[model samples]
Every structure is written in C-alpha cells, then in structure tokens.
Target: MLGIKEIEAIIPHRHPFLLIDCVEELEPGVRAVGYKCVTFHEDFFRGHFPQEPVMPGVLIIEALAQVGAVSILSVEENKGKVAYFGGINSAKFRRKVVPGDRLRLECEIIKQKGPVGIGRATATVDGKVAVTAELTFMIG
Candidate 1:
C-alpha cells in the first residue's frame, strides 16, 4: 500500500490536482489499484454543480491515468520519468460519482512496446463501475 507521499515519489502530481488519495495495490510496470475519497469540498464541485456535486467524468479518467502512471513509473528504468497521455479509446461513463464516494481506481498495463503502452482502466464506487477506458501512454 502506498500513501500520497510514496505516490508523489513515482508520479508528479500535487494536491487539488492529485485526484488519487492512496494506492491499495501496485505492481511496478504492470498494474495498480488506488483510491480517491470524493468530498463535497472538491474544487471542481464548485463549478461542476453547486447544488449537486458530481465528480467529472474526465477527472475520473485522469484518476485512472494516474494509477496507470504509478504502475509504469515505478519501474526502475522509468523512474523519474513522466507518462504522457498518448490517447484514450473506448471511454465510457456508466454511473455518477458524487461527494462522499470512495472511488476505486484499477489499471493494468495490457500492452507495451518500447516507451509506449496501453492500459485497461476502470473506476468504481461501491463495486459498481463508474468509468472505464483503454488508455495509451508514452513514457518520457
């Protein structure tokens, strides 16, 4: 398990923009499972909807990407590098994620060649999928 500090060591993301709160499971260069504790205080909630706070779907995809980053960046040779989004394919938003939801992020590197790779990613709340995507990344 990795807290925010250790996650920061692998990925370059800070508070407010750093959507992931903790990593529950990680396999360097392969997969990672992380969490985001959604709260009413989220900055996006202010503009996303004041009366009804819903975590943005794009941000949910970003959270999935961040988890995938931890998996790839933790590799010894890739340490200190950045994983830039190459593309996002087949992204789908299935359910609404609101404040007080503990969003679970799961990502597995399903394909890789050289510095480019693809991950099958998913985000869930209470075991119900909220979002999913095939994310491509370029390690630089």
Candidate 2:
C-alpha cells in the first residue's frame, strides 16, 4: 500500500488537481490500484452540468494516468523521471460518474521500453467499469 507521502513523491499533482486518493497496491512497473472520491465540490462539476453534473470522461482518464504514473515511476531506475501522456487509444466510457461515487482505477503496465511506456487501465464506479483505455506515456 502507498500512502499520500509515497504518492506525492512520484507525481507532481496536488489537492483539487491530485486525482488519486491512495494507491492500494503497486507492483513497480507492472500494476497498480488507486482510488478517488468524487465530490460535488469538484471544480469541473460547476460548469460541466449545472443542473445534472457528470464527471468528465477526460478526468476519468486522468485518474487512470495518475495511477499509471505511480506504477511506472516506482521502478528504481526511473525514479524522478517525468512521465508525460504520449497518446490514448481505444478509450471507452461505459457509465456516468457523478458526485458521491468512489472511483477505483486499475492499471496494468503492458510494456515499458526505454523511456516509452504503454498501459491498459480501467476506472470503476460502484464496481462497474466507467472508463477503460490504452494509455501511452513518455518517461524522461
């Protein structure tokens, strides 16, 4: 399990911007499980839908990326390297995520070659997948 202190060391995100609440499991560059709590006060909820707020799909992907970041950087060789989103493919949003939902993101590293990494991730809300994607990143 990774606490906030450990997470803060790997990613540059902060409160309101930090999507991952805690990393429940981590296997270096292999796999990770992270959590996020959706609240009505989320910044994007204000303008996303004034009357009927739905968490943005992009943010769901971002949450996945955050978990992927921690997993990738956990490798001792890549410590302190910057991880940037290189591309996204086959992304699907299956359900709407709103306030009061607790999101769990599961990410598995598909490949890590040199400074380039690829992963598959899924974000679940209430035990159902809300988003899934093939994410690529450049680490340097």
TM-scores of the candidates are: 0.99, 0.96
Highest-TM-score candidate = 1
Number of backbone collisions per candidate, in order? 0, 0
* Alpha carbon lDDT at 107, candidate 1: 99
Instruction: Please give the lDDT score at residue 25 for candidate 2.
Output: 92
Superposition error at 67 for model 2 (Å): 0.1
Highest lDDT: which candidate? 1
The lDDT, on a scale of 0 to 1, for candidate 1 is 0.96
lDDT for each of the candidates? 0.96, 0.92
- The pairs that clash in candidate 2 are none
Q: Residue-wise lDDT of candidate 2 within 1-140, one digit each (tens)?
A: 78788899998888877898899999999999999989999999999998999999999999999999999988998898878999999999999999999999999999888999899999998799899999999997
Residue 136 of model 2: what lDDT? Answer: 98
Model 1 lDDT tens row, 2-49: 999999999999987898999999999999999999998888999998
Which ten contiguous residues of candidate 1 have the minimum total lDDT?
48-57
Error of 1 at 45 (Å): 0.4
**What TM-score number comes out for model 2?**
0.96
For model 2, the stretches where C-alpha displacement exceeds 4 angstroms are none
